[model samples]
Target: MVSEAQLRTIIAEAVPTIDAAKLPADVAFADSGIDSLDYAAILLALQERHGLVVPDEDLSRTASIAGILAYAAEHRSDA
Candidate 1:
């Protein structure tokens, strides 16, 4: 089970400008100081590292940390 702490590391790696650990779980990435490009990088990292893939159509569903966790819980595959 992935935790918020782990996600914060991913976020920090994806965007080194901000303190990912301090970011709000409910805040959307765009509203939490993450730009589109950084958000994309974070998503890609999630896919590559954790196998959590967010398709184009469901992009809106995973805009925040909470949303990402929920999506990962629902869709993540260990295969």
Candidate 2:
């Protein structure tokens, strides 16, 4: 399953400007200064690497680290 560490790594790789290690778990990307473009890159990386696609309707469920983690735990697959 996709874990927080994996998510952080993805974020770090997707947006080099953002320090994923210091990112707050429950804070939304907007609150953390991660713009929509970078956030979309992170989401794309997650999809490309982990096969965890965040549907358009599920954007709210991935707005924060905690929320993304929860969504990954529930929807991430190893296939």
Candidate 3:
């Protein structure tokens, strides 16, 4: 169970220049100014941090913070 704080920290590290406070937890990544490269970077970061490999298909479908959170939760054991 990744806490909200952890998620925020991840986003902060991924996009240091962005004002994460203005971003909603359930908002889509596209609407949050996260481009494809940023998304790929995030997926890599998650893999390095949690030792879990997120599939490309899953990454494609994860458009929102909430969606990512749910995916992480479901794959917690793998992490």
lDDT of 2 at 41: 92
Query: What TM-score number comes out for model 3?
Result: 0.83
Across 19-77, the per-residue lDDT of candidate 1 in tens digits comes to: 89889999999998899999899888887878777889999998999989888887756
Candidate 2 C-alpha lDDT tens digits along 1-79:
5788998998888778879999999999999988899999988888888888888999999999999888888875630
Kindly give the number of clashing pairs for every candidate: 0, 0, 0
- Top-lDDT candidate index: 2
> For model 2, where is the 10-residue window of minimal lDDT?
70-79
What are the clashing pairs of model 3? Answer: none
lDDT of each: 0.86, 0.87, 0.75
Per-residue CA lDDT of model 3 for 1-79, tens digit only, reads 5655666777788888787666797888888898888777777777787665778767655566788778878888976
Supply candidate 2's per-residue lDDT for 49: 81
